[model samples]
Target: MFCTCLCLVLAVSGGVATTTAPSLADKHNALGFRVFAHLASADRNLVFSPHGLSAVLSMAQLGAAGTTDEAMKRVMGFSLRERGASRQHRRMRRQLRAEEALRTAGAVAVERTMSVEKAYRRALSRAFGSHPLQVDFGRPERAAEVLNAWVADHTAGAVPELLAPGSLSDETRLVLLDALHFRGLWKVPFDPRLTHRGLFRGANGSATPVAMMTLTGRFNYGEFSTAGGEDYDVVELPYRGDTLSMFLASPFEADTPLSALAADLSGRGTPEWTSRLGSVRRQLSVPRFAVDSELRLKTALTDAGLANIFNVATADFSRIAAHERLCVSDVLQTVKFEVDERGTEGAAATAAITYSRMAVEELTLDGPFLFFVQHKPTGAILFMGQFNHPT
Candidate 1:
């Protein structure tokens, strides 16, 4: 799991149609990828689900007010201010759940001592579909055990533990727990018989032998460039439901850093890139990988334009409860994923990823690259990552 954003901002409602998809999906995507670019560095295998993070944060945003509210609004670029916003969010949930292949669960755990407003509680249930939980933050370890138990139960033990030892403290007032599990089969499942050993070259020309899965089929594919003129290729591997798909991008030049491609993906170019992709036949090679990450996101979120939510002096959450002036203590996340010949199977991954493409053939991700698991119907990115040093 990989992501960080301080808080969410809810807008006062407008008349937008609830039948339409939430425009905020794009903003949610933006928040995720922006954080990815901020965290991208040498030799890290990052995995996160931005859609899940946004959903959890929206629960908290319903309780924000004043400067804290305004700050997040300016940063997230999406708001539930309009009367229709809530409807839109619900539509997204319904649209996402239309596929039984994917399962997601969320809950908001608030400090037991704080008296959260009933209105805020209702908003969480109505707008975000979250299960409300209250625990004793003063007893961080026991609180963690409760949260971990819920996560493990929902994720089938894939994430038996999320909160690290001492990651939570007495000062903590709120924690959001989200878990998503997806076992997607390729539209055309990869042939296990074709899986063979191949070398995945890494930074500085280091190569690790890996099991490479191969497929030659028609797919939505394209090639595009970054603002800095770094060229890259992309291919879409649709799941059985067609509502979700996996998109992969890699630099055409082996020497280029995955970060260059990551920057463009999290920016305005990403949506455009995906829109331009057309069906083409190609021979594709991708490594079998399993990645699980636990991250503390305060630094990454601050660097990614979410700096105000963690500042005690400036942070505001009065709309939530009145026990004390509550402020963010930490943003913790964990992500786990696996990919192989049976098709991609794993649970959890998120955000800004602007991308584009024409057509390409004979593509192989035998080196460092990027991957996104996207909800096609909503255009919301469920997972985002920079694949380097995968195991």
Candidate 2:
């Protein structure tokens, strides 16, 4: 497969187009960082799919009105209230699915006895590409089994069970889920013969030996700094088909925290600097690693300015099931990711900008760093994470 892209964004404000406001893609990416910033604990290897999670939330927003809809619009940046917003979302989804190596899925499971509004179901099917699955949530185990099976099928078993035992109960009026799986061969694969053991510096400054992958090639490299003036470096590694790429970044100074860079990147979209990257040949040493994490995002979302949906009284699902009482119980996202000599395989999270290094740049990630998996065509951050502790 051959992949190629560098997407751009047209900013908008209120109901008018503006050059100063954050674009739709930028807002979503920013939300990813805001959520990750909240979920981030002390030096934990965390990964979650911001793209997937947003899809589920957007689905929920379709059924909202009044204050509920307004909040979702403000927090997420785009809404059904905006002209052509749904069409834009659908177009973005189609562009992402065009690449065969990436798999994505979304679903809304409703209680077997309650009826879902046709308009809301149609909205999910049209905009998010998800169909409502009617299941008996009263039997929690059976409901979980059914939902998990569908998720496993979509993820190719990488995530067999997204919801563990007792995650659901008889009161589960609705369930929203998203599954993303991607396996991409590197455009320039790292040779295992050159791979060797090296010491990795943990977040706490402790060192441990890990398998390190080394590659010296010309890549889209850039040196940048946070608003607070902390320096960092970024390297772009494309998958076989240029459709997707992994952009890895880390602070240049050992004392500088990774969180600073993450926060800056969240404020800037990929296009802001991707076009400015200079092709440079650098000797790169990065740890081959994998991480699996389950993120409880209810508190994070509540903190991010969209809390009404989680509260039954304040929430509005009138567009979904007008006669029934429906409010979100919780939001959960599970992720599994891996990197090796051949390529990148992962599912799911975000968390900066520019300056440069002259001469032969030998960049090595021996400490905590952050990475982003981007859909180059749309400039959307599909997955992101902060690797404080190697797994």
Candidate 3:
């Protein structure tokens, strides 16, 4: 009678993790960039939560069996079946929950025909702080309302509608939903007065007017060459909490496509940039934009070689429910991200003074660029996308 909703929200303030495992974090970032590449576009703005999607899928993997489990592990880069994987996940979730800036909540709703496993519920509780609830999926409209309400409540209204009417039906056996809302303020706020309409060079070689934010300050900056030997620039903008930051990258040549940069990102991941970044004073210009993306990941997952879980005949979720021949009917993720002049509260009061006498290097994102929101210490990519045209 119940439809399940797995909701996750990551809000970065000004704190960083000190205990994150490098190897584990690398695997996470690698998987995140791979997902971004699968969803990449050169002409459109894109944003999605890799961490959110990973969390939901990982939770589902707890109940998987045989090749279904193997395929997930192969694509996700980590296996829940591995020794101490669940404990490590539990520790990581606890650390995230301890941060005042990060908010996460997950729920599993069960139908009467399916029986929820105690061990699976316990794992969910320990790893995601999730609780189980019963809802009537037979009444699809009512199930939709319940799940949507839960998402809205957990995300503090950032995501109001996760499921549209008829997204669920009597035939629906399982639904996995994840939502992440992040509104991070810059460490040093951009002067609102300096935000003016500037021409953004489009991927098609056309230009459009956009509100560009400008600031001159010290930031983590680096320049690197892609596998194709093309040069590009990367700049890190730390949110109020130093723990989370957004890294922006753009090619040096105007004619160079953003896809090239995306390919490099997916191939090498963030360590390539993070290892090279150094504190530098620069005049940074970034567009003020908001992106909302909704994705049904079945296609993306399948394309990434995770097709077995979606196949009802071959699928095995005996760990969660042995009663019904349940397969993942739908896996959905929604994300809302906004960047503006304001950062976390008290950032202005605590903003550091950068007194530089030399000419500052300018880094402007007036064209298509790729970005990733990262958990600093752990190097886990929470979100990754391309900003081609502001939405």
What lDDT would each prediction earn against the true structure? Answer: 0.69, 0.71, 0.66
* Tens digit of per-residue lDDT, candidate 2, span 1-391: 1111100000011110236666566667877888888887657788777776676677677877888898888888778536777788888877777878866666677777877788988887778777777878779899878877876677676566666787666766667665556778998999999999998888877788999999998988888878898888788988888978988888876767777887777666667767657899888888998877766677898999877766766766678777665666557665668889998776432100000022356878888888888878888888788788665
lDDT of 3 by residue, 1-391 (tens): 0011244211111111225454665776777677677777767777766676677777777777778778888888887657877777767665655555666555666654556778877766766566767777778789778877877676666555766776666654444444333446677889999998999887877788999999998988877787788878888888777988888888888777777887877776567658778898888999987666666666777788877766666667667766555565445665556677885211000000000012248778898888777777666677777877755
Per-residue lDDT for 12-91 in model 1, tens only? Answer: 11111124443668889988777777677767787776776676556656666888787777766666644778888878
The candidate that wins on lDDT is 2
Q: Model 2, residue 247: what's the lDDT?
A: 88
Q: Each candidate's TM vs. the true structure?
A: 0.87, 0.89, 0.86
Which predicted model would earn the best TM-score?
2
Candidate achieving higher lDDT, 1 or 2: 2
Candidate 2 minimal-lDDT segment of 10 residues: 4-13
Q: How would the candidate models be sorted by lDDT, starting from the highest? A: 2, 1, 3
Which regions of candidate 3 deviate over 4 angstroms? Answer: 1-22, 173-181, 343-360
